[model samples]
Target chain A: MSSQIFSPGLQQALDLVGIFVFALSGGLLAVRKNMDIFGICVLAEATALGGGVMRDLVIGATPVAAFSDLGYFSTPLAAGLVVFFLHPQVERINTAVQTLDAAGLGLFCVAGTIKAHDYGLGFVPSVALGMLTAAGGGVVRDLLALEPPALLRWDREIYAVPALVGSTVVAALIAGNRLTPLNAGAAALSAFAIRMLALRYGWRAPRAWHRNDSRTSEE
Target chain B: MSSQIFSPGLQQALDLVGIFVFALSGGLLAVRKNMDIFGICVLAEATALGGGVMRDLVIGATPVAAFSDLGYFSTPLAAGLVVFFLHPQVERINTAVQTLDAAGLGLFCVAGTIKAHDYGLGFVPSVALGMLTAAGGGVVRDLLALEPPALLRWDREIYAVPALVGSTVVAALIAGNRLTPLNAGAAALSAFAIRMLALRYGWRAPRAWHRNDSRTSEE
Candidate 1:
């Protein structure tokens, strides 16, 4: 595949937006960790692009996107700049960051699925890669922040499940030869709505049997 | 295609040995991070099996080995127990730890390549996965420890390169219908020797021009 196809202007725009939100999330986590600016930026970059880079390499794409595209590499840098200069103001708007992050989760799920499909992966693998691409960065971010993985933590809202749903819808649509812009929009909407509902209603997966055993016995 | 083939008694033995060394390295890193017992165990498990788990999932192997094998999962717990009680004694044998770590790297590279080949990947991708399986865990460990990744640091020895060489040799032998226990032994020895030499001699790749222009230089 031509790098040009991967660099369509619209995709670039979406990637930059995703990076900004991802970096903001990372910065917020770093603040919770009381990290310096360097830590914040490193975490931000890892959160924004770590998944995509891993996906690209696994699919045998040479010169991973993070290394090949200056714009892609610099998106987190811009976000880091914002965090460095406006952290105090940013801290007051955590809700807005969460909303944008939800949007990023939706966008990345679609983009990652498409990328995996382009590499000729089967639908199941594409959906799996999509979820990984959407959630892998957050996993790294939380690990670096020394928090339990957000996907594994009891307090996390519906995150990976929504991304999985979105990717599944997209994969099914693509397989059916109905992957038009409208279908993509619907898939993204489904993911965004699920995440928003989870946030607003505090939706969460039921913990496995073992998870509660320790807590209930402690109490 | 048989899970039994992959989970053979010999593979289990190799995995146990690799996990022990990897867990030791991870525990050492946790000591540097000042983590508690739980944190040390978490890091140790992540370090010992994270790379292999990643390689398996990428290759579409379900029920990741680390999760499926009670012995594999318990290895890190055993290591954690040792660290909790014998950290001072372990700390005094830094050289021994390094040697064991080299052995683990060799085992991981071979096992990763063999698994990837079983999944029907081409030679190049198998080699790449092997290198990733050898190095990816330590990269995650360093990220969690808030240290520069050993693979990315300027002080890098022949860490990835040795894995690449070993995996390539294994793949080539398999392709040529010359693979045997002796060939496997030769490949592992080659990888371990190169890694030890690099460690002793401080070998590293040349940086690309302008590579240090990024934030990594600030370190």
Candidate 2:
């Protein structure tokens, strides 16, 4: 079951890459906030691991990933060190961080959906958990940074939508018993494509009507 | 079962107070961050409801508190209004805020543990969930404010520890079938006393060796 659920080598590689990219973004935010080195490391670790930890606990998985995996714990620390030494270089390549962040989102969403399915949830719940898995870290990051959640903002480019799409595709594949490498590939591609398209087009969820009407009511 | 857990009137009152206090803190933080009224309201709702929402989902309780009760949703809005108009007065009484926050912590810890136990977890797991329930909203709040989590700080007066103590007492009571009103009173008093003592005496968790060692290594 473990072999079928995850390719250990591929999963490890993906975890490392995801951790690094997420940590980079989190570290950058810390710098913007004028936090000390320790603060930067904490933010980075939270950004990289918070969502998955939450996901694992909710699903009754014991000894969460950050606790069990040295690499997962250390990757954020390493990223924090790099940011500490290379702030100028990182600031100059901020756009690159955003791109990598998009990639991390894609990977986490797919991985999250797959993991949820492995834990024996139905399709609907699997999709919901997958969406949470993908967006949860970023949400936590935003909260710690005192920013409105990117997911809650109408101005931000699509975030949760891509995760939703990815999870739905994976759920469909699993439901059909076609959970092959190709299915996994398709899920990742769909998520990435949706995210990139949202970025390019500056797409956002429509605000509920009361959102605007109530603002005027307040004034 | 509901009657055994709480008299309907007491439950309603506690829920109202919890929502009001939680939302007030969230809204005040948003105001301090210079968010617009809508943003303040959104955050207020999130802060007041986030922990309960998470607890409900984990326990497979559908139609979470915020969704099912408009009063739950509106409590934050009311708190937002109070913060909007009474900012200076509230700021002047920061001590009161802290006291109220401690009370909230105690209530949430006990309530959360009872709910978790009701959902069929063993003693230890129930205590863990109770701590999470008490601390999770604040963690979320700090994260949004882009501040390092207060709970993770080395010098934050005892916060999570009090919740842990509270949860332990409650779990012990429930497990031993000694969950009488008197026991409940004792648990709440103990929690409140420990938290207040921590505040008064500036009690802190003993710093792990790794904390100082890590700082030295970084230096």
Best by TM-score: 2
Clashing pairs in model 1, backbone N/Cα/C closer than 3 A: none
Compared with the true structure, what per-residue lDDT tens digits does model 1 show for residues B62-131? Answer: 6788899899899988887788788888888988888888888888888788777777776766776787
Candidate 1 stretches greater than 4 Å from native: A1-219, B2-10, B210-216
Span of 10 residues, lowest total lDDT, candidate 1 chain A: A1-10
Report the C-alpha lDDT of model 2 over A87-179, residue by residue, as the tens digit. 789989977787777778877877877776676656766676677677777777777787667665556787877888888988898899888
Q: Score the docking of each candidate (DockQ).
A: 0.04, 0.08
TM-score of chain B of 2: 0.90
Candidate 1's C-alpha lDDT?
A: 0.77
How many pairs of residues collide in each model?
0, 11
lDDT of 2 by residue, B92-163 (tens): 787787777777777778888888888888999889888877778777766665557778887789888888
After TM-score superposition, the amount by which residue A7's alpha carbon in candidate 2 deviates from its true location, in angstroms, is 3.3
